[model samples]
Target: AAGAGAAAGAGAAAEDVPEVERESPAKAPVARRRRTVLLAGTAVVAAVAAAALVVNLVPDKGHNDRSGKQSVGTAASESVDSSPDASEPSGAKGRSASPSASRSGSPTASAPASVSASRSREAAAAQGGDGSADGATAPAVAVNPYKWEDPCSQHYLIDQNPEQVPPPPAEPDARGWVNALGGVAGGQQMLALTVQGTGKATVVLEALHVRVVEKSAPLAWNDFEMGVGCGGGVETTSFGVDLDAGRPSLSPKAGQRDFPYKVSESDPEVFYVFADARTHNVSWYLELDWSSGDRHGAVRLDDKGKPFRTSGNVGRPAYTYPLGDTEWGRNESYPDIPG
Candidate 1:
């Protein structure tokens, strides 16, 4: 049986054999050539990978900048060596000492010129008086205007008179300063120009009901940066009087004739006279044009340029010169008016 099976297998194998295999022993060489081609391909791939890795591992070269570094080389060393000397003045060896330093020739004779000059300036300032031209005894300016004279230099408005009124509700010791507006009777409502030492000035008028209203500072004071407001009260509005106008007139408005105040001009000075309705008495107020050499003449003229007169209802006590009787100052000159 085994011989028969072997004979059958040989017959089948002979039948399956291809014509190409039967003709050649060249299969081994073909396989070897294929393996050689595969090896060559692998070598090329590895060489390309190695070249890429080399490029990635190495870095490019660049410029060497020293300026950004804290310490550069020889240049920096030279700069460090010369820096301190360069800080000195170019010709420092020949330069003289400042005024504060004196020569060594005489030790005790050398005064500190700077200190001496400072002392002299201080002495001059002390002698020249304070910021105000007036010496130290200026008025106690509880409430005062800008252009007011030294109240201390001159006597006050209300001397030790029994009739002197005390300050209003808030302040008591404050003395009544002479109102800048003269010939104003103690209680009369008059328009007044008042000033304070703060470099401020204002115009205020007392109305019929004793209500005070502040008026605009004249354009001049506003331009000068002076303050503007109605002064606190009667005692605050101090002034240097132009007392020369005596037997002053008191005029009232045409409609309100009962109250009287004076309005008149003597060259550069203008006066306002009024009645102190509280005391049922008469008084006067004077206003001087400090800038003009004479009184503001036009103020005395009516709108129609008529000589300004007190209204008829403004009555007089038939007594002589109430305000003139009070002492004003050394240089003040009183005006003469017919009673």
Candidate 2:
């Protein structure tokens, strides 16, 4: 079986920051992180070449968080000067910046969720939910549900807080919650989420989508199976998610492809989806997820006849989550994600 793999990339920030009325005080955790990175990352300083360069390099924190800036398509251009020779290392292996400056996490596209603002909490509740179809194997899904279970909270922006923007509901339509995002090419599953703040948010999806396409004796498209619905605390502004089944049977394995795992030449399957938040006109994509397994997800069925999901890089960065802390991975846990 192949582990799951998903990729989420923040495209670019918008041209201008839209002003808002509220002034969120700096939170303790955010302050700590900011201070730590500020003092530690000397690379940020070396990137500034001249007076004109200095003006654009700093990220604006007053109007929105870093997460908001990252989503804006042009924010990075506004901050850093583009030169053919400017490059920096992210301090991670297999990751380096080039003169043109493309940022990525290890060979994958998972960046961190750059949300550093205030946040509130609510339990994961079912909204806009309908009973599953009897004998329907498709996973349940929630389309554009309320960001918060507490419908009356200040951050719950569906209807209660008209002026506020809520974290993206899992699906775009605000209708049903499926078990997972449907499959695409490369044996991956994916869904789409819209993040709208100042468009400055930095969404780092750590998983990739895997799909199974057959050229000969193609299986009926109807035979495709998926699991959709939101139950975990994984966060993104509504994500395009999918699962992969690696191996010939229901057994598990590591990484994308192995020699024994080769498919028939006539029907070689591509098993990865790169979903990015950057606004672009490219054919490839970068997605975000909560586990590295999301990155290793497989499309081919394993020996046990069970499908497998790869881990995405978007999960908590630490090796482990805080024990007994249910809020640890909550989507609303991030300040930008909404309560």
Badly placed stretches (over 4 Å) of model 1 are 1-24, 63-339
Candidate 1 residue 130 C-alpha distance from true site, Å? 74
- lDDT tens digits by residue: candidate 1, 69-132: 4223444444444444444566653434321122222253122222322333344356552222
Candidate 2's displacement at residue 251, Å, is: 5.8
Stretches > 4 Å off in candidate 2: 1-75, 79-81, 85-259, 263-266, 269-339
All candidates: TM-score: 0.15, 0.14
Q: State the local distance difference test value for candidate 2.
A: 0.25
> How many residue pairs clash (N, CA or C atoms closer than 3 angstroms) in each of the candidate models, in the order given?
27, 115
